[model samples]
Target chain A: MISSDVIRGYNDTFLLSLLTKGDSYGYDLSRQIRELTDDAYIIKETTMYSAFARLKKNGYITSYPGTVTQGKKRTYYSITENGRNYLKEKRQEWRITKEVVDKLVGGDNK
Target chain B: MNTIREYIEQMFKGVPVTEETVQLKADILGNLEDKYTALKESGASEHEAIVTVIAEFGDIDELLEEFGVSRVNEQVTKNYETMSESDLRQYIQAKGKMGWNIGLGVLACLTGVAGLLLFLAFQSVLSGALYIGLLFLVGFSVIGIGLFIIEGMKAGELERFSSPYIILPGDKEQFISEQKDYKRSFIFSIVAGVSLCIMSITPILVGALTAVLPILVGVAFSLLLIGVGIIFFTYSGNIWSAYESIKHNGKYVEVIEKETVKHKRNKKVDYVIDEIYWPIIVVIYFVFSFTQGTWAWSWIIFILAGALESTIKSLAGSWDKD
Candidate 1:
């Protein structure tokens, strides 16, 4: 399992990446994140909520009150244009970060 | 499902109910429901699903802080400080009753005084009438003492009357309006009390124009003070009741539960001591007065007993500290 602290900075990236496909509510996004990680990571409910609040506040995502299903209403979040750009930048940042850390750790292992 | 909902409500108790907060609560509950359903589908028992779902829901404070809302619990702690709900209610009710009992007792004593003054004023009129008046004075004094004792007992009984815990339901706007009304009433009561105190002394100043009128004016002033004091006392009581009803909102469940446990532990011993203390002091006063025929000095026994009772209480408190 990936430690949450190791992935904390990328939580917005994960959420925004999920919303890029289409709009999704909290539970659906959480489930998708867990599945994408092959059940090795579970984003805490609070973590997911904080990420959503931060993403929406920064204009990276927009939320709307979705239609109630079976008497339960959900807040659906969709990525913004700025969110797409941020996700692309985050992907590039991740590539550089992983490359540097992998080299240092791989050299130590060898 | 009902249990889950109740759990969610309890978790959100101290959070301010804004539009964003309302949405957050609904979203969390919806997510929990999904989790619970999934667990149950995977052949988890109902109890297991509830336990697992709750354990996974994470801390409520984090969510509240993330949303930038001030916690109601923290605000209650700051405002009320160390006063538990039961302690606060009991303190206020006891204060009100004490005010009432003292006011009525003073009035009763004044009735005896008035009767005695009547007897003295008409002593030369007829001996029979004066003796009858003296008898009435004694009767009134006894009745005054009796009423004091009875009222004290009734107040003790009221201490055991447990008030129900209620949450104030309105939003921030409603709370502000209610608070405004409370402050206005509070200021009005203080102003009335101060004005009445000043007015009460006016009779004495007016009596300066005449000789014998001063005594009559003084007596009237005392009665007026008692009347106004009682009015202010009860009005303050109402104000405190309103404050308590609002101040302890969202936190009453925990406060009341703690009070019940503490009350149950201390009640029996405290009740016995409280029930007998005043009666014993009264009995000592009567016994000393009747046996020694020292009415002048026997009143000192009450003052001494009051001092002794307080000293004993402080000693016990210090011992507990040790």
Candidate 2:
């Protein structure tokens, strides 16, 4: 199971990676993260919005206004090429981290 | 499923859900909904599944921190650190307004003096210049008092009390105490000195020395009095923030323990007290001295009135509990 800290540290990467596939809004993005993690990781709306702001600020994502169901105009965010590259780098970092952690923790489990 | 939906709805409920926040909220909700559907399929009750999903979302503040959005109240946070804390606090207490009003008072004084001198130059046996001097003094006095009233109103207004986070920015209790003492001492010192110069100078001179002594004494007195006024007021500026903090209940002024350099977020600091505080006194003094009265006593009285005014003001300022 992923710790809360781990999810927080990686929220930006996960959101950007998800958007790189297609544009999405807040609720949908949080739902997607749960699906991908098999419910192991979930991002709150507040967390997701904050990550979106950061990603947008860093030029990794762009947001535009669009209408969703219930006549609500929602902001939709899409990943930029820069965001894709950022996700790639973060993914590599996560891989290295997982490898190091597994070696350390699984050593005794086995 | 129920718990997740409830949490999702709650999160979005009161928030503006502006375009930027909405997009992120929607994405998170979608991810949650998917999990809820899967959990329901696995035979978890709707409410249980939703609760489980909501519980996993984690702390919101940490999430916002990554985006640098957690420091949302940047203006309040920056107020203390952006300027010299002492300077900013003084600035808010309408010190600049004070300085501005003092300048006006000085101008009014000069104007009264000019009016009086003109009256003397133009006067004849038929019409004396005394009335002109009195008129000018009275006119300028009105203007000076008007400025003081306006400054007080500005200081007391609700809008001026506003800071980003809390009341006047600093240790508010200490601020109030120091301000009280400062105002008290300042007013007392000026009034006492002026009264001494006016009421006691003759007795002092008669009792002490007689040659060129009175003139020397007058020079010494002026220098000493002006010097003391400047020193006390300058020190008072340093504690002005504390005064404001105390007045504000220490809530509005956000005391920033950490330093930040962004000045745009910092509120008012380092106001010009001289502008507001000195003008009326100066106007009254110069008007009385340079206008209708040429006697040495006139100068003494002018200076004495100024001293008395300062004392009264200080007393009034200290009346507040803060």
Candidate 3:
């Protein structure tokens, strides 16, 4: 149940990481995120949708109506070269951010 | 399916419709349909699939905020209040009752017309029947118009129908499902009404040719059937009118249900609305094939609805454990 505000900054990072693995449609991406987080975080459809628009607008991802294995027309997203660079930059930023936050909160506040 | 489509449509309402917005809408629909199909294929019931898809559809304001659209400003632009869940349910239920009022009203009017027609068609046999016919017309039309005025005030809530409040998503879902169910009923009403209208004419044609049944009685039966048909239309048709004009949604329904269960409250509030809907006039119509006092039943029901509407509303909104 991480707040959207907490993750809003990294929505692109999370999405592009997944997109770099392979092209994926909206539902499939949501499904993968749900599984990957072990259900800790489930993205709302609107949130996912907004992220897609932002990614496409920023030229970080490209979309086309791709046919899935089931033969349904799906809007699929794949990470662009620019998207890959952005994800890498985010990863580096997160490494330092996580270490700094962890130290400030202590080893295990709980 | 209409529920889902309508829900999405309601969200996109008020925003300027555009090519990009249309594509976004299509993409959103595409995702939802895909998820729904997968859920169904994985053995979710139709009801379960729909609920899951809608529950997960998320908030429109979340989308609006991301896009830097000011929803608050939009509300202020119009004198709109956030419509509470109870307000919506009351509106819907009132709207449902209004349907019955109008349907019954139409029935009364038509029966009155039928009574007069019966006299006209069989004036040769029955002496002074035209007076009775005139009485029927005057009596029933007065009752019909009375019902219209009563309904005008009740559904005058229609002024608040689209205004006064924002629909939370949960309440919105409740309404969407209710509207979906009512929409199916509406289709049934259309078929039944049209069939009834057709059948109303047949008795006259058959009776005039065969002289088997009295033409007056046949005419009465014919008009009564048409009246019933119209009842179906007004009852279901009101829902569509509300659906088109409303741009609201809800999550308050879920919260209310939770509170109801948590309190261990009396959840069963079964309304015996036949007292309010199928009142004495209809009974009289049934008793004598065409009674002198048709106004007694339709307005009896109409007045009854007006009287008990408060009780129905109170129970729906504020009934506690006691």
Query: For every candidate, what share of the true interface contacts is present?
Result: 0.72, 0.51, 0.67
Interface RMSDs of the predictions, in order, are 1.0, 4.2, 1.8
lDDT of each: 0.68, 0.57, 0.70
Candidates in descending lDDT order: 3, 1, 2
Candidate closer to the true structure by DockQ (higher is better), 1 or 3: 1
Over the stretch B1-322, how does candidate 1's per-residue lDDT look in tens digits?
7788999999887765446777898899999899899889999999999997787677777776666665665444333323333444454566566655655665566566556655555566668766776687688678768867876676666442333332223332354465577676677775775565556555555655567565444544544564555456455645455454445332342354455454443444445556888789879877986698543345456557767876775666556447
lDDT (Cα, tens digit) per residue for candidate 2, span B1-322: 4556577666544332233334556666665676667678999987788777776565665544553232324445444322233433565455645644654654555455445554554465428567976787678767766765776676555333343223222344555666676786656655654554355345335424655444434433443334334333334442453355445433432233232222112321212224644566567766875586433355455446556755754555455315
Query: Which whole-number lDDT from 0 to 100 does residue A76 have in model 3?
Result: 84
Q: What's candidate 1's DockQ score?
A: 0.51
Off by over 4 Å in 3: A1-110, B1-78, B120-126, B163-165, B214-217, B247-322
User: How do all the candidates rank in terms of DockQ, highest first?
Assistant: 1, 3, 2
Output DockQ, candidate 2.
0.27
Candidate 2: segments with Cα more than 4 A from true spot: A1-8, A12-32, A35-40, A45-92, A98-110, B1-95, B102-106, B121-134, B158-322
Q: Kindly report which residue pairs in candidate 1 clash with one another.
A: none
Which structure is stronger by lDDT: 2 or 3? 3
lDDT of 2 at A2: 68
State the displacement of the C-alpha of residue B4, model 3, in Å, after optimal TM-score superposition. 43
